[model samples]
Target: MDTAGFTNLLTRPGPYATVLADVSQDSDNAAHAKELRVRAACEELSAQGAPPDVVAEVSDRLAANVRLPAPAARVVVATPEGVAYDQVAVAEVPNQVATWDPLPDLGSWIAARDSSVSFVLVLVDHAGGEISLWDSGLPRPTSTTTVEGDELEHVQKVQDDVGWAAYRMQQTTDNVWRHNADKVAEEVTRLVRDHGHDLVLVGGDPHSVSRLRDVLADQPVEVVELESGQRAADGGEEALHDAIRSALMDRVVRQRTALVRRLEEAWGRGDRAATGVRDVADAFVTGRVETLLIDPDALAGRTLDPADHPGLTFGEAPVSGPVEAGEALVAAAVLTDAQVCVLPASVLGDAPVAALLRWA
Candidate 1:
């Protein structure tokens, strides 16, 4: 998903520098450090001229107290207080910070999907005193189970059962200095095996996450780590949000590529032609079309042809006449349920045509 761009959005100017100083100057600065870092991150985003709504989003994410709404384009988070909401540019009433309930949010996430069934796995790393998990497919915990013991031993057992499921687990910690780091890694492995999930998320201190990754270097699952502490069931919402974002990004890329390929192939046939709206409209009136691809821009100004063209076959006593170029093409495509590609200007340069109707 172009996370790099999103990550850049979180970058701030002075927060890191001040936070680093606190981390070095005081032993009790851990929590304070996190708060400062989060604040700094938010400030950085605000400075970038991110819409006020987007800025609020970063704030809400950094605050553990509030649960932001699902499918939010922008959110405002207040540390240990709660979250605020806005739509596009209009702000909405904020919700209170309540006990962590992953079920409802999970359900909402799943309902948004067009797919029938999906598998999701949640991985929590309490080693660094943080909880993190990845949720994909199926909202609401279908099953909740726990394992307790020496962290390392438990994670090893999980790995043995899951058979290389740790690779996709996000590395939350980069250091191995956390207490029971090994145990956290073991538990993560166990969770993956017990629940046949498609995605794995790891949450905890940097050190703890590093150790866990080292233990599960060969796993095949997709792992993601969050920059927060373990908080029981609360981590579910965050994990689900990350998984949804990841899934959506992948779907968009795949759809865009497929559409482009179909258009290119049709253009290569040479038999197909797309010029002004009239030419394309004539082709659709007859049954000589297979797929229709339209450039939203092209649709803005186009005129239909009067005469019926190739590929279209009307019933007996056909009423032949010109239709509004853009409207006619869209109507025909919809009526036939033909594949439609909404191309941008760049794609239009190569093929400004709509449907890949029949070959000339």
Candidate 2:
């Protein structure tokens, strides 16, 4: 997910309705049941005063677009404008908790399934190989490409022409190998730029794996060579998944640790940081916040409009019910084109949220 994509989801004007559900079907009966359940759930939200138009739109869209999960999936739907559905298998999406709220509940689920970050899996051998763009929210590859080289083994083995035939065959093989490598490099680079993927895992034949990595070494994202992998449809995919998980997990850890250090530095500076909800909210209104770090656990604070300010306000009670603070800050961040990353409780210390400001 690029900044624009996430920004759209976060900043869409409310009242928003977000739902994550399992719509997997095993039989005709299961499929029918799932369909009815979806309609019923949408209707239930409508009954609870969700926008009639949005509900109608969601219903029609879900009816037309809903797909049975392979085994099971996490299907997320949002209102007004944005992605109506995002899903992946139980093994990939992991936890599935159905939810509907005025705000999109992607906070808890973004890193696990819906984040734009994805792994490019390349399994290459001498003859040919497969490259798959993998994202947790979708059960299969978003894009796939096959890398194949011209056959030269039999030509090399021919004895009639002696060394000459072997030499020519070797030349042709080299050409084919370079051509295939170039194709993989071009496609993978495009995916990294256009689709927001930032990591790649290459496995299979040792020579081929190293060559592919060298091809992508100039790309900014991580390009790792693994011990083994195959492009099988099932069962044989574990190696690739395991390698991807490990690499991405390392990235997540490094990112979180770096963010903590940055927060500490900003706080020490005093002027460029905001720790509590009130201060963070104020920072957002002033357009000072460049990055927001929030704990998904403490997202329920209410921040109401202050009389003097037009954009946003905090630390004031309202005569009427107030907007959820987390949602409000997210909206502000998106509107201001700032970044938001989930900061866990341990790293966040006592604050519900924090901001690293662009300026004092």
- Candidate 1 lDDT tens digits, 168-271: 23232222234455565565566667755445555544555666667656666665554443545665666545655565466446666776676677668765
Model 2 residue runs over 4 Å out of place are 1-3, 6-14, 22-48, 51-116, 153-176, 231-235, 304-310, 313-321
- TM per prediction: 0.34, 0.74
Output the lDDT of residue 33, model 2: 67
| Ten-residue stretch with the least lDDT total in model 1 | 14-23
User: Best candidate, TM-score-wise?
Assistant: 2
On a 0 to 100 scale, what is the lDDT of residue 79 in model 1? Answer: 17
TM-score of 1: 0.34
What digit string (tens of lDDT, one per residue) describes model 2 on residues 1-360? 123445545434455565544466767886786587667768677776777676766555545534435445444556656454454444333434333455555554543432335678777766667778886555677788886655644554567776887788787777777666666677778778887677788877676666778888888878877655755455266766686667667766777788889888877777688887777777877889888887756664445343324566322212124555665666566667778887765666577788888997
Mark the regions of model 1 whose C-alpha exceeds 4 Å error after superposition: 1-232, 271-279, 286-288, 305-323, 350-352, 358-360
